[model samples]
Target chain A: MTMLEVLDVSGLVTFQDSGRRGWQSYGVPLSGPMDWFAHRAANSMLNNSTDAVVIEIGLGEAMFRAKRDCVLAVTGTGFEVVNYIWTFPLWTSFYVRAGWRVQVKKISGGNWAYLGVAGGFEAQSMLGSKSTYLRGGLGSAIRAGDILEAGKPARELAKLTARNFPVEKFMNYSQSPVIEVIAGPQQDRFTEEGVQTFYGSEYTLSKSFDRMGYRLELLPSPSSAKGIAQATSADLLSEGMTLGSIQVPDNGQPIVMMADSPATGGYPKIANVIRADLPLLAQCEAGVSKIQFREIMLEEAQENFQKLNKAFKTPKG
Target chain B: MLKPLGDSALLVQLGDEINPALNQRVHALNALLQNPIHGILETVPAYSTLLIHYDPLTLTFDQAAHWVRDKMTQLDDSFHRTPRRLEVPVRYGNASGPDLETVAVSKGISPADVIRIHSEREYTVYMMGFTPGFPYMGTLDERLIMPRIATPRTLVKAGTVAIAASQTGIYPLDSPGGWHLIGWTPLKLFDPTSETPFLFSPGDVVKFIPLESLESNSLLFDQ
Candidate 1:
């Protein structure tokens, strides 16, 4: 089934899936959806395979026109969805009539939104994934006036009607989230006070944020302006870095490594935000979203991660 | 020390500095577990650490840590396998290398002396990072060591052979890089179509051979 012609794209829209895996050893980053839960949720609502390629839209407004009638689901945090003058709620499947226009506008509370067709968007898959890595010139790049083709939907538009998922059950983006984290590999490199401050202090997501990292700033305060101090000033021997790894460089603020973070880094990591709260951190509006960090034990973090996976589990009928 | 990284992977830290001994142990552990444990997914070996990605659903953090810790105890420290030796051909000076004169002038050496100093040493592929298939080779001759340029160029063409403090590397793909560009290589470091995409692997020994002219390997750039 072929549909969805891109009309206008003010934001960066690219095709993404579960990400390219098993290539990190060669210095390749696992480029995928910034909001892992939202991507899977959109696909599940349409009974699409969990690994289906969805369009990741970031930076604000975009417009798409359907070439033919198709079943579509849009999920993310606080994005307004409209077909003509009629608005539609997110996290639910909707039938788009042929030649109708769909407009997605960012109202507030998030930086990314996912558009998953029932059959999933067909895109250029390189190195075992359709996830777009623009820097590496790897996957599909969607621009204004491009034609998007998709595979056959498991069921026609009629069967996907009325299927809706409550986003609040999995994530509540409205509130300033108290994100959970675990100790990182270089946790010992931070001062005792630094560890305490990282967990206690409120941080604002800086504008210097991207798929590589989300640099966090110590929320301005009367006394705690120096930020998280370090035990050592030396950079660590460059080593493998993982997603959510919170590296506190010489400046003392933290940079949360994200989906497209390099395979390795040299900065001293203070702590790592748990996998469960990464989506929440990724969605935070840069410079606008206030964030807090709460340290959790490894077992607790494991349970939290599993809970998120369960919510995003696939093959829905 | 085996430490948990968030809830997805474990960081096996072998040492605190960049040394061949530490890199050997890193690659040793990687070789031992070429076929990963039941729940482990992939292993990424770096200068002094190895990151093992795992499935959180199948293996709990403790279970994965326990399995790797057992292997660490039995890790072979002795250098058993002979490293692979390969030569990378480079076109130095002139249009192929825009910064050759500046680099030579900065180091108070002729361009030929700089090339001779850079290509003589057989550097070890310490790790692959910065970009895909971009090897972080080390033991750069002290005479040629230069810190990265203050202002990085917006577009450093792919296959640009460059150097930074104590290291020499190739730009596998066109990227914005700050490294001091000393030469250019017709060889593609990253070939996604090949059986082995990356030209250099950790634990391999690489030597750079300067290309006096390109007529010898015109077919290389064709691919």
Candidate 2:
């Protein structure tokens, strides 16, 4: 069996697939990679399927050593990585000599990164997901001294070696982008001014951002009299929540729910960041990542999401 | 009413409040749509709303809305199906129940009376959320209803029986909560290794049986 030994790890690192599906009724959360685009890119570089298992490296830094000759890809923001003696780059796959170390070093920009080895990481599947959901006690995080295993590569090691994925073809993380939203299910709970305050203002991604949700603090407008986005209703009845739900509590700071958010919540959701923009939002570094919101129709959101899926059909050079 | 939740899901509001009648309707609708409807990926039934998850490429929001509407027409609003009833054994009013005396005092009753009133009537499983298998059982006798403590405890232990507002809940895992602690159960509500991890589903029925003292049920852990 193909394998890699975890030599060192900092922060939280876990194996995630395309999330657990079809189990919300029993109160199970949909746990998966924080950044889907980067996770998939790491998989695509090695000709693996979109849902193939990959390592999600979160927070400070992590390091791993290949126990056997294999192929691997690294993607995501914030950290500079060192693959063996080479000054490595992100978004590309390369062959690994047995016993070489691929160290994820320096958090200069983002929070999470993906390391997709040849084939996929093999972990005990719980409820049909290889994803590690710490809250549910499902799968565990990868730790130092732990031996991680993977299935043999799908193709010849020679053919899978050195596959390059261009950064320009993907959602570029360099620019400060306008994340789009469709009005949330509980939009009626807020006044027109409340909706405006959400759409017309800049918000900073606060430190509370995680796989559960990205908490956004509304920046004060230039004119103080514009007013805050307070909900007309005091306490909302708890209801089912979707991925990317922008729930505003009493403080009026919007918390955009992510892949592992609870199935149900009580806060009045003003809007939902469209599915097409979740990956971009997920890649944003806490405190450092500044974002703005744009309201778009549901049809347009759906179209943009389809376009994104289509673009990932093949990464451009 | 059909509400849009991003590009992937639709929230179907069947009723306005958290009434049992409303919840039954939600569960009925939940049962109908759960049987492998084309494009409908999953149905999450809450207190008064049913959330439908779908594949965007196969079904648009409008298409899912239309399909749900079509399914609604066929649902029996008076739907009453036999539910799985579970009896949970709990040890009340000691170290297990930190707020048992306070709850009884607030209601002008003795701690034992509080236990009797709580264990008397069976409650309905309104929803399962906040954690795995933490059944949100409700309709506590109005006489027993008490406000949740002002400050939520940072960490409540697993299998703790707690009461807040009008619902009774069991802590399946160690989670931060605000409910008044009244007892604890040895039986695990979330047994991960079992084929059925959760002890209750959304539409199930549950009753709490008072235990005199702690009993060893160590087989329920470290699976």
Clashes of 1: 0
Quote the B-chain TM-score, candidate 2.
0.92
Model 1 Cα lDDT, one tens digit per residue, B1-223? 8888878889898887778877878888888777777789889998888989998989987888888988877786563667899988888877777898899999999999999999988988889988898989888988988888999999988989989999989999989899988888878788776677778888799998887644566533421
- TM value for model 1: 0.95
**Clash pairs detected, candidate 2:** A78-A109, A78-A110, A184-A271
True contacts kept of each: 0.84, 0.72
**Candidate 2 residue runs with Cα over 4 Å from true position:** A223-228, A314-317, B213-223
Error of 1 at B207 (Å): 0.6
- The 10-residue segment of model 2 chain A with minimum total lDDT is A222-231
Quote the positional error of residue A284 for candidate 2 in Å. Answer: 1.5
lDDT of 2 by residue, A1-317 (tens): 75798999988899999999877877788888888878888988887778899999988678888888988888988877797677678877888889998898866667788999878888888888889999989988889989888887778878887777776664767436699889887787776787777777877788877788888776667621343456465666678888899888876778888878998899888888887788788877666767888989999999988877775686333
Measured against the true two-chain complex, the DockQ scores of the candidates, in the order shown, are 0.78, 0.74
Candidate 1 C-alpha lDDT tens digits along A76-158: 87688999889988888899999999999888888899998889999876888889887777864688899999999988779
TM-score of chain A of 1: 0.96
